[model samples]
Target: MAAEQAPSSNDVRTWERIDFHAHLLPDFYQRALTETGEAGPDGMSAAPGWNVQDALSMMDRTGIRFAVLSLSSPGVHFGDDAAARRLARRINEFGAALVTEQPDRFAMLATLPLPDVDGAVAELEYALDVLHLDGVAIETNARGLYPGDDAMRPVFEALEARSALLFLHPTSPPNHGSVSFGRPRPILEFPLETTRAVIDLVLAGTLRRSPRVRVLVPHGGGALAVLADRVATLAPAQMDLGDVDVIAELGALYYDVAGMPVPRQLPALLQLASKDRLLYGSDWPFTPIPIIEAMAAAIGSTDLLTDADREHIGWRNAVTLLPRLAALAH
Candidate 1:
């Protein structure tokens, strides 16, 4: 039997196709033909509407050069410490191997066992030192503990020490009383939860303490724009340690225009963040890739960013923080 023939590379320019946010689940998690009674209307766990090969084919058609893979929500964050730890290892190994097999077409954001400091640290070491993942993708909350909870300090510290990129994706809190009025999460819950998480992190001083850890928030930073002023007004002038504006410190974070129309939101984001801190990410699998491309195109057409700035947000910032991707970006 002859060896399998590899697909030929296309002529699309590298810069034309950098999708920062894409998700893929392991085959073990596929619920398409799942016998478990957990299948939702859409299909699988979170997004049953799409799959791995479907995403890659879409990328090819759209001229998307690469996609940074992350596990969809509730990612090892809800399980007990032991289960979470094992799941993190499984996801990272699966993701790293995918990148290894298709070096030029894929990269990864490792998942970690949150709210479990020791497990988080262990997973980070394994992911960075051994598997060589690009970064870690953490949901806004772990069970009921937000990323900024005191228990999560060590996780942030480790990520900061490693200069890791922590992509913050939103997930609904475990308890919901009034919000879930026969609606799917993405319509409103996702953004609402992100706002809550952002506020918690800012008030908790996570941003100030972890200066080296660069975070990228999704869904146009979900309620961040509208709530910035309110947070500043209510924040105390001084913490026991120092005086800092909670809102101002938010500028230190990076945000992606995933699933948002760039023309409508990029200008607002520019007012709140440095051009270099803004990135292009497509919440693929959940949303269509074409919409993401349109957002990027709209942003590119705005003339709001210079060539260097575009390059930085579109590719370089990710590469700088994700040392594993340094050569790939070049």
Candidate 2:
């Protein structure tokens, strides 16, 4: 397929980018937000403006070839299982429609009705088998139930059986009240919760049981990059993997640079995940287009990454995970 029209910026339009951590808000989800008058999921600010045209325009401008869309935080569940199941299907169908409309420009990570284990599995089958999505997007914690919860094992088993591409995103920790000192949840809370979730997931041994599951943690794996030793120290006592190297286990999973890949984040991310495991993400709509473009430039110029490594993170690494996007390589 021909590339989309280029933006005014003449930096270099030679390659296409794959965004592994973008989001979509269905009409129903938006309506719910409107009804509640929410500023967004963290309840701190309004949900960012989102629409396919805006997302695609930004992608074209920024050299992003394809984006894997997922529902943002405060996922499908709101204490009502029926609402969760219905919304999951509705939102997924909305995403599938986009892929159908523009196969090259859009693909989706199906949202699940999680913490409702059976509902999640059922949604997974429908989304994958029928809708043919790229994979599923799971929150770090679904309805306050982190990935490690035993109750969600069957769902993980189903995903593992398929060797699924599971994208893990952070949700606000349940102890929001205690942490808030007039600061929004995204500040220190988001990364801390993400760190806790990843560690807990590892401790639960979900990865061991689902060895084939290809996992991608967003925001450069949150604080997990520098927390390896802390995790390693705790792992031996927290879970019974007699002689396993905790760092190795953490390294095996993939991570995306959605937010700015600043100085502190770059080293740890590169050290933890090899070139092939680091993918690009804009966190579009939530992250302003200008910021995403700046992130791309910053990451592109950083000496910490060789040209080849940056190339893989920007576009090539994703081909291995979702072959459909590989067409761009030609």
Q: Against the true structure, whose lDDT is highest?
A: 2
Query: What are the per-residue Cα lDDT tens digits for candidate 1 across 21-41?
Result: 788866664542243332442
Off by over 4 Å in 1: 1-15, 31-38, 41-46, 49-51, 77-79, 237-241, 303-312, 323-330
Q: Give the TM-score of candidate 2.
A: 0.93
State the lDDT of candidate 2 residue by residue for 1-330, as single tens digits: 999976533242444678888999766788876664454668567778778888888888888888889998878887779888998999999999999998988889999998899999999999998999989998888768888889888888888888899998887888787876757777677778888888887777777778998998888888888888887887688668777777887889998988876777988877787878999998888788778877887777678877777678878889898887878774
lDDT score of model 1?
A: 0.73
Model 1 lowest lDDT segment of ten: 35-44
